[model samples]
Target chain A: MSANPVSRARLFGSAAIVITTLAALIAAVLSIGPSGLVWAGIIGAVALGYAALSFVLHLSYPDAAEAAWDEQNTVAHRDSLIFGFWAVLWVFLVFLALSLTGRMDPAMAFYWLGPVLGAVPPAHYVVSVLRGRAE
Target chain B: MTTKLIVHLRVYRAQAKLTQAELANLIGVSRKTINTIENGVFTPSTTLALTLAKALNCSVHDLFALPE
Candidate 1:
């Protein structure tokens, strides 16, 4: 939200990390090679580090971070859930049609469902921000 | 048939010389929350509305009003 250079730099850095990590994850899953474990380990380590940092921040800066978290949980999360509703519906409908037409397996639809639904929030956020309509 | 909620938060925020992020920090909300509330894309809860009103040095009714 802060368009200051420092804040923008930090946001871009964080986004870069997320993008790279996700790309690695997808490649790992697709290839199922030895690097898969490496990628999984990296992701696990990042998750653990993030959790630890968040715990520390919550403890140290209880008011600021917790308030933000509360707002996110109550407000942003509610919006995300609404978006997820339509996202899941449309995704399933499309996938169902694809499966019925013998293009994709029905089981794959169920398999991809959670990830696709999960992506809706970040996707919406990114698109909204890019379009300057996030507010 | 029902009228949509209209928020005059941006005017108050401008008068207070506060950016959305600054006001959000003051009221302990995410900037996105403040931005959305100002743009009328989202409405604040009662507590948040009161908090915003207090921070902006205005009454709740002064901060948010019907279009009459």
Candidate 2:
């Protein structure tokens, strides 16, 4: 409701994502009854869900007469995107590595490419937003 | 080498089988924001553009295109 509440929204959104992801990771680890990548993959899936959740939450602003962010929000947008892209890339590489360890088939790893590619643009957009690198 | 944002958010939203409120809920933005965007009252930033693009199952260029 503040005239400039983007930062607050972002902070709250980020907190929600971090908490949810961490909680999921803990839950997966505790429930698995074993110390291994099975739980790790579960954690990764939850993190991925929360990352998408953060974006959905960002879309919930109430102003029909206003845009999602203010004029200065491009920098934040770009930064988010850049971070997201790197995170996805890192996670994908790690997943590929894990799959190759003989637990999962290499071809199965390709299944993750969709989500990984999907995240890159948003991450890059975040980076660009933070850098004021609008088009 | 080229940059253009032509389609605009309004047009894309119209194609997505969503009212402003429906789309707003999906994107976590207010209906007012959705309405404003549809009316060309404001332009979405890069983050928003990506989110909307994802939700609508289209490219950013599909939602926004370069000027002719």
Candidate 3:
């Protein structure tokens, strides 16, 4: 099969994580006395660090599978950073609406969909890693 | 980066326990896509990778490999 753009998914996944993490921090700051948000910030920092490292690894190794980082692929990284902001805003608006309606717990602020997206089978990812292919 | 070793088309498909048709159906793509990927003529998208990885129950690393 001709290779399709694999970066887009990477972009989406990383963006989603960053956005969710940021939202968690913000919510923690505004509501639960900055401590939780501070910790969340720490986690965000860690995630960002890993993201950067992944990028470098991908560039240097290219074919290295673990180098297939969360938001590291060259093309995908940009998309994730840009789209991440937008996705978070969308999520924020959603949370805002929920808050106003008093329909859900504010703690729902964590990145929910990111993990649930486990809908995509892990088996294929493993295959891609071993095969040195994007997908 | 250096050029790396890659899997044989047949090996990868078998490892995923996927017939080309089954994988294509799951990904909402055509079997031709799977066949191409299997033949080393195709590279999948990041989205497709995640989908495949998720189904395979392993990290993308396990699926794709680098040359020694």
Off by over 4 Å in 1: A3-57, A70-73, A128-135, B1-22
Off by over 4 Å in 2: A1-7, A32-68, A103-135, B1-68
lDDT of 1: 0.64
| Model-by-model DockQ, in order | 0.36, 0.06, 0.04
Question: For candidate 1, lDDT tens digit of each residue in B1-68?
Answer: 65567688899999999998888778777677787777776667788899899999998887777667
lDDT values for all models: 0.64, 0.56, 0.50
lDDT of 1 by residue, A13-83 (tens): 33444564667657745975457446556645654555566566556666556444544335554665688
lDDT of 3 at A124: 31
Candidate 1 docks with a DockQ of 0.36
Model 3: interface root-mean-square deviation in Å: 11.0
Better of 1 and 2 by TM-score: 1
TM-score of chain A of 1: 0.55
Task: Provide fnat values for all models in the order shown.
Answer: 0.30, 0.07, 0.00
Which ranges of candidate 3 are over 4 A from the true structure?
A: A1-34, A62-90, A101-135, B1-36, B39-68
Q: Looking at model 1 chain A, report the run of 10 residues with the lowest lDDT sum.
A: A4-13
